[model samples]
Target: MVQPFSQSRVKPEQNLKSLSSFNEAVRLLRESNSIVITTHINPDGDGIGSELALSRALRYADRMEDSKAGLHKPKTISIINVNPTPRNYQFLDVDNEIRTFDETRDAPTILQADLVVVLDTNHPMRLRTMEPYVLRSNAQKLCIDHHLDTSNFADVYLIDEEASSTGEIVMKVVEELTSHQIDAQMATCLYAAIMTDTGSFRYPRTDAELHRTIADLLELGADPTYIYDQIYDQWSPNRLRLLGNALSNIRVLYDGKLAIMTVTQEMLSATATTDAETDNFSTYPMSIAGVLLGVLLVELPDGVKMSFRSKGD
Candidate 1:
């Protein structure tokens, strides 16, 4: 079984290594005049939240620097993603800064930017349609992510696999960039990112430090109740019915150690719900008594998307 949160503290050496990357990344941000930020295709809460929060923080820092130097030219920052923001996460983009990538328009921006910041995923392929452009760009690339097995595409990498989410790592960077002056909007985005990726702080990597970070976010104006409601409570009636259908069809196997749930295209059409509505369906199977592993298989037009949730190592 996965270890308890109390037993999963981050190692000291990991912090030191992460700090070095952080320093390099901050220096690059300070020098860049124009920047483009993006996340993986079909982004989850962690990716979207980190992208928005980091972009906002960078712009805020630029404005502060401009005021102090009496310079009107602030760094130009654009958030371009391969896919449109999910309906649920649209609330966090309060300023509506996120733009769906258009090759004709965004290609030039990517090529012209002094820096390109890729959040959440480390692999360039995860950027999908934007991958070639990102690779072709001469801009200094910086990747901020929490996943393992990173590609060497970026000029600077701020990666911490031990982090609960990319949002957690971005929180530290935001603090350093803004001098601990995180605003309410940024706090809300980070809170949503960390909360969702940590499964509401119940995941294995969640620990005292993570909770402390959450507390800091709350004090900075992240409303947990509101964010939770916005993300989970806003599900459509058809979406809830789709979940019910999936639960009803769950198949138990291996003497109750495994549970499998399948959502076919027919099921989706019947319920008038799309595949995106099946985000957390795997969690339901893992919640069953005596089940060690849960598998959610969603059949799309082209292929099947599989999600796994397991209780043990």
Candidate 2:
């Protein structure tokens, strides 16, 4: 039987006002065993990248020769998510460690976890179908996210909304956990996280420190060109055709202040493309000369899905 979250044995650290929150988070993670890592549903690069990076870092504990170094490694460190990794991001799963959650298959793992680290999201509902199990689990919960919403569900919150990405927050935690010597695998994941979230380092969050971090990642064996190619250059003919069809339907609204495009089931079928092929398709509308806001309306079987992006503010 899983324990209730409120009864967690770990006491909150004294200094909630300072970096002690981070220190305490690190302490809880270091002391925990049977750890399970997860992120939000339909995860983007930041969520997936952060999950993989932290998973790799935690796995390092098992390799440590010194058992007395206070590396209280869990017997199992599982990376599970509500949805499958996007086709393009599959390259980062070098270890093939990410598993999709199934109620029958993964509920036991969730229930048995001594610590559940939720990355890139703070709300349990963001966990989708896995929310109930995560909420009921007696394990200590830790949230490492950059989203503005800091709704207090997790026992430990390592949130920095000002940070470029959740990957940035995870980088700091990983460094603190590993004594600042991150492995190449960690670097690749973090690089992907920051890269996608910052729109290839052009977003407002891309500061000097972020550039330095990217430089360090490059020095530590992250192949930026290869990563970019894998994510952007590998589109199939069907996907391109689908994009062409969607773009043809672009509609200017609010006197060019908004650009709207729709990808319907008929268009997808005509183009021989799956819905997954439309991932990040909203960027196309935003690229218009005078568009300030871009919207992509995807026609799902049950409903219409919408995504919005803005030029500024």
Candidate 3:
């Protein structure tokens, strides 16, 4: 039998505070003329999805405002990133709006923008090559993230540590800005964001309210089965062989409490797979019985990349 999931309720006071922050973020969007939106380097579903969703919502709002006021000018919004979108996530950017940063072209736009919005990551360092440009920008900075231990860099921040993903917060912002009018594209982007960050709604923070929010997304045209297939089921044959190699290399230690898997460069070369293909490989070790901690190490040309996952507190 399936058991009911427990809830992790946010305090009423926290809701009020988050509301206030959302309102302030909306105000900044209304005031800005040119906006540059970016996310952390080696971007994941959460970052890329949030960026696309927010960008669409902002454009929708601008169109409504322009129609109301009989104006011709629309706000300039650009989605720039230090790294290109991962292959699995490229489908979300249907219009191909995301740009891989070219300093000469993007630096001028970042510098001259009226606002710079950083999503899914709070710290500037996470922005990698784009960090210096963001820091040097005279534009008002706004950060929308659910990560903890934020740096004091952004001029306005909407950081909700209790939220499941940055997509959850961006959804609220989209709701407020567009008056609950989210289209299918925005819904798909947001669904991908929340789904990936919450580990398909199985993460520790997947509460009732988060499910309700996801339900709302479904009504707005987010196809869960399709999105899931696109994200997790689209692996190449080579990638599956790579995973097989990793699983074969797993070793148990410390009385079977720890499970470790390594994906060496040789294996990657032989399988014709890259480190990105090993995104959730750490979960495999944790699937073993009696294993409390799972670790995945992938060897790159320069160094070894490590991923860790644990079962409990």
Q: Quick one: best TM-score, which candidate?
A: 3
Q: Which consecutive 10 residues in model 3 have the weakest lDDT in total?
A: 1-10
TM-score, cand. 1 vs. native: 0.93
lDDT of 3 by residue, 1-313 (tens): 1111113344655666656666788899878999999999899999999999999999999999998898658999999999999888999999899999999999999999999999999899988878999999999999999888999999888987878899988888887778888999999999999999999998877888899989989999999999999888998999999999989889999999999999999999999888888988889999999999999999999999999988866
**lDDT agreement with native, every candidate:** 0.89, 0.84, 0.90
Per-candidate Cα RMSD to the true structure, in Å, reads 4.1, 6.3, 4.3
Whole-structure CA lDDT of model 1: 0.89
Using all chains and alpha carbons, the TM-scores for the candidates as numbered come to 0.93, 0.91, 0.94
Worst lDDT run of 10 residues, candidate 2, spans: 1-10
Residue pairs in clash, model 1: none
Tell me which of candidates 1 and 2 scores higher on TM-score.
1
Residue range 138-176, candidate 1, lDDT tens digits: 999999998999989999998878889999988888887
Error of 1 at 128 (Å): 0.6
Ranking by lDDT: 3, 1, 2
